[model samples]
Target chain A: AQTVTQSQPEMSVQEAETVTLSCTYDTSESDYYLFWYKQPPSRQMILVIRQEAYKQQNATENRFSVNFQKAAKSFSLKISDSQLGDAAMYFCAYRRRTSYDKVIFGPGTSLSVIP
Target chain B: DAGVTQSPTHLIKTRGQQVTLRCSPKSGHDTVSWYQQALGQGPQFIFQYYEEEERQRGNFPDRFSGHQFPNYSSELNVNALLLGDSALYLCASSFWTGQGIYEQYFGPGTRLTVT
Candidate 1:
């Protein structure tokens, strides 16, 4: 069983600043996938970024990136140049590499971008 | 690409009643996964449909069942719903390369309210 944890329930950042959302997971499997998903007021779950465990290089998507520490079993999301549009509930998820279909999600972190 | 789309953006059902949700996968996507998001929590995986078969499922009860059509569209049925079933039902789709990448695109979700 894989369990994902998000310590921060709420986070706030000033406009144009950077913010990092923490995420940790307990997984017995060595190969898996980590992801960051954003849900806005509309409650639409949107993929922000994804990191493959087998890849040493981190994943970056525009202003969103992930710091994946395999040994620590941590995958944190860093949102640079934060905008109001970035304000949302962010969730960390996990899926095994061998069976990528079954996914597990962490409690979300509510991010507020303050002007 | 229409992305993943779900019907009936909102629904209201009574306890012990039954409910059905629909989903249309993204263009060029062959996999559809369903999730349940409780208020103030992350979305929990329900099931995943690929090749018109249920490839994986979460810890949900047998009351939850689903079907995937040849068009790749899907339906989720829950019998004898409970108030605990009240949540936003999200549908996500992804292209299956048969590898570890499960970078899914999510829909706006159907908000199911069980009274």
Candidate 2:
């Protein structure tokens, strides 16, 4: 069974600064997908970024990017130029390469963008 | 286009009672997946529906069941609910490619309280 882990329960970043949330996973599959999701106080879950295990290059989306280290089983998210809107609970997820597999999510890291 | 939507933003039920939650998939989406998110935790997969059939399921018990309609809408039903069942129920919609499922969009989620 695959499991996702987010070690940090809480994190804070000053406005306009950068922040990084750490994530690690255990999986037997050689190829899979990793995702970062954000949940605001409104409680809406939104996809932040995703990385494919086979891709050695990290994934970047605007201010959100991922440092995906397949050998270390680590996938960390970096948010640059952070704004107040970035304050939210961030979750790391894992999904197998199969078509119908279910996603596995970590506990989450609550990020506070300090003004 | 409309996004994924869930019914009864909030619900309250007594012990041993039964509860039903509904979900409408996003436009052009053909797969619906259900998840349970407890307070201060990440969402846990319950089950997924595709082509009106249960394509995949997580580690949840049989007490939790679901159905998918031809239009890609879905429903989650819990029987003899317990206080432990109280949580936020989420619905995610995605397009199923022949190889695998890509991005999944989530709904606001329905908060269920079992007293």
Candidate 3:
């Protein structure tokens, strides 16, 4: 079975600063995917970013990027120029790159952006 | 195009009761996946539906079942619900392009409170 781990239960960052949320996973499968999701107090879950395990280059979307070290089984999310709107609970997830697969998620890290 | 959408934003049920949740996938997406997120925890995969069939499931028990329609919409049914079943049920949708990776879109989620 595959499992995802987010070591940090909570974190804080100053506005306009950068923050990195750490995540690791244990998976025997070679072809898979990693993802980061954000859930605000409203409970609206939204996809922040995703990375392909087989790809050497990491994935980035605007100010959000992932540091994916396949050999280390680590996929951390980096949020640059953090804003108050970034305050939320972030979850790390994993899924196999098959025709159909279920996504496994880590506990989560509650992020608080201070102005 | 609308993103993923779920009905009954909030529900309260008692133990041993049955509950059904609905999900409509994003436009152009043919796959729908369900997840359960407990308080202060990340979302855990429940199952995935494609082509009106269940293609993948997590470690959940037989009491949990689901169905998909030709329109790519889906329904999740949980029978004999226990107090532990209280959680936020999420629905995610993605396009199966048979590619390396596909980004999934998530809905706001339905909060199920079992009493």
Candidate 4:
């Protein structure tokens, strides 16, 4: 069985600053996918970024990027130039490369962007 | 284009009652997945439907069943609901590329309260 762990329960960063959220997963599969999703108070889940296990290079999407260390099984999300809109519940998720695989999510970390 | 859409933004039901939640996949998306997110917790995978059949399921009881229509719309049916079933149910849609690398677009979840 695979499991995702998000160590931080809560995090805060000043606007225009940077913050990093930690995530680790336990999986036996060699090839898989890791993701970060943000859910606002409106309760909509939005994809922030994703990383492929085989890709040595980390994934980056504008202000959101991931530090995927395959050997350590650690995938972290770094938000640069944080804004008020970044205050939300962020979840780390895992999925297998199979087309029909189900996604597993971590407990989540609540982020607060201080203005 | 519109993203995923769920019906009945909120629902309240009594214990032991049954409830059904509907989801319409985004345009051109053929796969639909259902997740249950408890308060302050991340979403848990319930199941995934593709080609009008359930292809994958998580550690959920049989009471949680689902169906995918020909048009790619899906429905999650929970029978004999318990208080533990009260949570925000999210529906995500994605296209299954042959390579098995595609991002899921989530819908504004349906909040189900079992009292």
Candidate 4: stretches off by over 4 Å: none
Colliding residue pairs in candidate 3:
none
Off by over 4 Å in 1: B98-100
Q: Tell the DockQ for candidate 3.
A: 0.78
Candidate 1: the clashing residue pairs are: none
For DockQ, the strongest prediction is: 4
Stretches of candidate 3 exceeding 4 Å from the true structure: none
lDDT-based ranking: 4, 2, 3, 1
Candidate 4 residue-wise lDDT at B94: 92
Q: What share of the true interface contacts does each candidate keep?
A: 0.82, 0.87, 0.84, 0.89
What tier of docking accuracy does candidate 3 attain? Answer: medium
What is the i-RMS of every prediction? 1.4, 0.9, 1.2, 0.9
Q: Name the lDDT of candidate 2.
A: 0.94
lDDT of 2 by residue, A1-115 (tens): 8899999999999999999999999999998999999999998999999888888999999999999989899999999999999999999999997775788999999999999
So what's the TM-score on candidate 3? 0.95
Q: For model 1, what is the C-alpha lDDT against the true structure? A: 0.90
Candidate 2: C-alpha RMSD to true structure equals 1.2
Give per-residue CA lDDT, model 2, range B1-115, as digits (tens): 8899999999999999999999999999989999999999999999999999998888898999999999989999999999999999999999866656487999999999999
TM-score of chain A of 1: 0.97
For all candidates in order, the CA lDDT equals 0.90, 0.94, 0.92, 0.95
Candidate 3 lDDT by residue in tens digits, B1-100: 7888899999999999999999999999999999998999988889989899888888899999999999999999999999999999999998867554
